[model samples]
Target: MNAQTDHASTVSGRQVARAALWLDLLHRQFPELIEELAPGRTGAPGRSAPPPDAAASARRSAADRADRDAALWNEQHGLRGAGGGSAPLRLHVSDALRDITDGVVELEEAIRDRLGLGRPPRADVPARLRRIAGLLASVADHPVLAEHVLAECRRMSRRCSAALGEAEQLVRVRGRCPWCDSVSLRAFPAWRAVLCVNPGCRCTEADCECRTSPGHRHTWAETSWSQLALDAGVDESELAVLVEAAEPADGSGSVSGSESVGGSGSAA
Candidate 1:
């Protein structure tokens, strides 16, 4: 029992750290995306020559320049989207970076999660063979019979095709709505955040479309992991456990350890 508990704890720690690594990477990148979307830097204007007169000069300049202003505007700023494609080029690069950043993150995180769960702790798996081993071990039976247990561990593998399928199929509908836990779409418990499923009423705002519907009852996407797990027929804790298992291993089969299961990390 001590070995089982100790081993599980060690594995759990490694898993948490790896999961944190991926999450921290994303947390850092999210701000970068926000920054990229921000307006370009605005520097102080350079000094210019003063006009010969104040109000009179302004009126005279306006009247005189009005005729050529349209042409001048085009020449000074370059044509719309025609600054040698520099602005658009930079924007494309920025957008590409954003997309790669988002994609690599999702891919790496998904891969890591899959690896972590492929093999649960030797003790956690539920099987007839595992039960037999535990019963034998409890009676101080021979450890040579551990071959059966080891074989069972080697044979079992995690199945996350469901999660992957869900990720691809799930449509995120944004809105302003409190979290609710109905058989219908729901939100996360603590934060009451939601991701709606009403494609006809989908939104892309910071808050989901729930707010647009006056007095509408719906769940928050950010707050609904439990419901997703329930609907998927898995415990929410399984998500955390899977994350732990995904940590990159060192030279050995073991990992460095990770945070405790079902941590407060927001699934967002």
Candidate 2:
């Protein structure tokens, strides 16, 4: 492949991988959420109590409160019908999963037809995603087909994420993005992802260590929060404080901010 096509393929692959990751996370968490909302379900099988860490405990408390609120909303809406306590939540999750699964299956069929490929065996959500990703990889040289597949993957990812309430809680980090210097950095607690919203973020600077491509927005997972803080010239503790403070008082998914911090060096 030419350089341009190669770059496009790489970017497309990354996006597809990201979409798959997010969907897989939702697939795992959805069941947990259902269990949480279920009456007398207690917790997942063999789920042990969390260790005695204050921060961990506090996070669990916040999550518990959010679950309680969700349950209350279900009750208010009269969702607790003959189907059982978790039926409404289960139905919602099932619909979301089905939507994504169907979308992926359709895309797979389209790609298979275009390539004159034989029908594949039935597969679950994760397997379907993997098959689609493989199909995209095989068609990387075909820009139109690759792009189409990538778009479908992203659409499914977005739908699943919305269903899972992944973006429901956003905490505005206190500093500008270290790469783009835009004050558009936001931490999504539900997804454990931080995003720099600037589309033209210059994250490819020599000293910058972000994994995202230049000109695209940068994303960091929870593991990179400390690195993000370091790049933004803020202490990790301060970052934690800002995130906590920015969380909505009523647990509504809203953007809030704390005091701004001084800018750090341009490079991470």
Candidate 3:
């Protein structure tokens, strides 16, 4: 598969595994919550009876069974209240859902940190959080809440997948520093500048005089593309316009600030 596809698949797999582990932990910690959320009747002991849709029955496969098992493990672990549920039991379930929602937030943060990119503004995050909170506050059973949480986790996973693809593209633009043979060299695609990894080297790809004393440079400074863009003869306003124009309205490829291009939009 292509790099983007591979990255996305890896991300989705990791997220699914993490989600499964967290769900298992949640199930163990609050068995009663699981029981309350079980698919069966209010007082039934097992999974709720399956609907008699022929299409659903026909579509059942090994994957479907696995999903059902996961759902059961995550949601169906508790016993229903005999009459009115105990206050403590209800409180525990509510707390668990809220805790799970918090965990989802943490997961998203961790993904962004790992990807090494600042989290761009997302219009979906607030709404997702609200939905999770609403699910927690409502009288939904554990299974229902677990399903919603899992779905939200997958949505975040998809978002991360997209981010990772963007990162891969940035890495390609930020080519290696030939002076020190360092792949960690920085690039500002907009400015068409690249920096050597050695701090003393201070040599940008656009100016290579520092190569004379590269042996003395040890640490590397983080490259700033905006400043470099100005150094390359583009004003801030022009850079902003270039950035906006280069970005596809369809959201396919992001305009990476560190792209390296030759004089005519060809690869250097």
Candidate 4:
């Protein structure tokens, strides 16, 4: 990635900071993702690009996206009813998704730095980061934090899938090594690749489990995009868009603002 990612610092604090940034990033990327995956297929190729094939393509996309979410959800958590559903669910899901997205971004960037896959966070976002960080720090003691984290993660299972795909492509071109894109590694059986949600670890391979705990800062355990779809109720195609929308950039870079990442996915 880039050198600007190091600014997140090595600690739980980075999760919070990155969460905020990533939430903003998702909003910014959502439109692009929707356009890319569904993008309204050209229906008869007429004056106005026909009617745009929204029927068949949309269903296929939804299923594909859902499958991606199931993969992520399967590994780290089970499933929950948003613990509130709809109104409250959306609020919580939205908040948690934003945080988790940012935190994951931070963790990914941090891990990249460890494995030399990317650069460190920069100090430019300090002012805005502090605002979102304050919210996470304020609720540090709430029992719901973990639930919120998981819920947030669960909600993002789909987005995470898209991100993994993008990351996978990057890995493909650069290399699939969980570490930096420096080395090449293949997946096992039906799996394609893995992604790390932690920031300080060293993992050069797809199944790497290295984390900040040991000196191995770049390694990490990444579930496949297929896992997320397996767990969540979201359509596979829609879920795919979520994954794309949620993918973090090379560095800890994000749309803007940030909060702490979730300890678990919403399914937890």
Candidate 5:
């Protein structure tokens, strides 16, 4: 192949790999998502529950307060009855999963048509994902078509991730933000940055010249995380804990903010 063709092939191969990897991850995480959405059950016999730490207790309290607030708001706004509870949230999750499944099926049909392939066999989401990955691999030689397919794959992967509760997994930082002096610092592992989530913080404007931008924000990149720890008077060990907490619970590789369908998109 010519040099141009070689470059196109390389790009297409990389995109295909990334798209397939995301789909595979979603397939693996599907069971965990279902378990989380399902009602909690009693601990198994001979297996004791771990005692809640102070942090865990505090988190539970905060969550309870938030739930109560949500219930009050819903009741006042006629969004739900007096004691609606978490049923509505569960319904939304179900609808989101259904939509993602439908999109995947449609994409499968589209790809089969583009590749002059026959209808796919009736299968579950995991099986469909495997089939889609195989179809994407077949199209890698045609760069333009591969690009479109890869874009669709990325879009579906992102939707699947969000529906499965894998996106926006923010970890709270222990100390105040060094730049903003706000206690709203959070580590966004996908972006590999720690930032203040407070809206009124001026850190972004101080760093950049986008003073007039309404939603401007700033982050301390991985390179500067150590500096942030020092500035915030957080110990190195504590900083390490924050990093560990930011990692995916399943130990899967994080999908970086830059890897979305559009090159300029942010996963955060």
Candidate 6:
């Protein structure tokens, strides 16, 4: 049992590390995607800049920008408040980052699992895969290449599905509300916060510009591992272990040593 657990831990660690590498590459290579889709970075969705006016100029602060973006997004999506005005956007920009980051990781993992090769530790995995598939696609009417590329595209689609799976998993987790969870569509991990992808969730607590709904219920607890570690006065290594144990992994209450939302990805 001990040996099996150790092996699983090792495999899981490698998988997470490789996924992180891909995310880094994606961040580096296609930063525009990050800028457009990433939380906080994502601007007002599907809305053109308003005509210049004193009021528009007044809403130039980052917090105001985020609020306008969220409001515009909610309006475009036809997601009106249940009882009255706009539903207070509960999820924030960090939540958006978390969703996109987790989605990218899961997509990489899915591709690897489906291809049965995972991502080879050579160059940028997604880029490499895309290049190969593109080259194959360029070869017109070649049966073998066509078959191979088709297979690759099919697997890629599965990656999209896997990316979605993470959101579904996050939605029903013990502490958060289903509406918040459902609204959370993508995530991208940052140094300290998880970005929320849902347009409705586009601000951080510190910069929130949205009105709070009385019915809005946040189920997640407010426990801080770093604060706890500081209070405990543990060494770096000890703090690492304690922090790992406290995070929700694979939706299991117990730590499985596998990285998740609040895991090494966040540290990255």
Per-candidate local distance difference test = 0.36, 0.60, 0.40, 0.38, 0.64, 0.36
lDDT by residue for model 5 over 176-226, one digit each (tens)? 666667666666654557777777666544555325555656677778877
Residue range 236-257, candidate 1, lDDT tens digits: 5654444334432433322223
Q: Estimate each model's TM-score.
A: 0.24, 0.40, 0.23, 0.27, 0.50, 0.22
Give per-residue CA lDDT, model 2, range 1-268, as digits (tens): 6898778778666544444444454345444444443346455789975566998889967876775577668778965545534455655666776777688678878878777787767887667656765665566656567657655654565556566655554555667788777777866544556788666665665644344555445677778888988886657776555543433223232334434444422222
Better of 1 and 4 by TM-score: 4
Tens-digit lDDT track of model 4 for 5-110: 3332233344444354554544444444433443335655455543438897899678656654554464347553433322322333344445544665564344
For candidate 1, the lDDT comes to 0.36
Candidate 4: 10-residue stretch with minimal lDDT? 259-268
Higher TM-score: candidate 2 or 3? 2
How many residue pairs clash per model?
A: 28, 0, 12, 66, 0, 25
Model 4 collision count: 66
Task: For candidate 3, write residues 139-243 as lDDT tens digits.
Answer: 122333334445554333333323222331322223334444444444433233344444544555544446456453322232444563444433444433433
Which pairs clash inside model 5? Answer: none
Better of 3 and 6 by TM-score: 3
- TM-score leader: 5
Query: Candidate 4, which segments miss by more than 4 Å at Cα?
Result: 1-11, 36-137, 141-268
Question: What residue pairs are clashing in model 2?
Answer: none
Q: How displaced is residue 201 in candidate 3, in Å?
A: 8.5
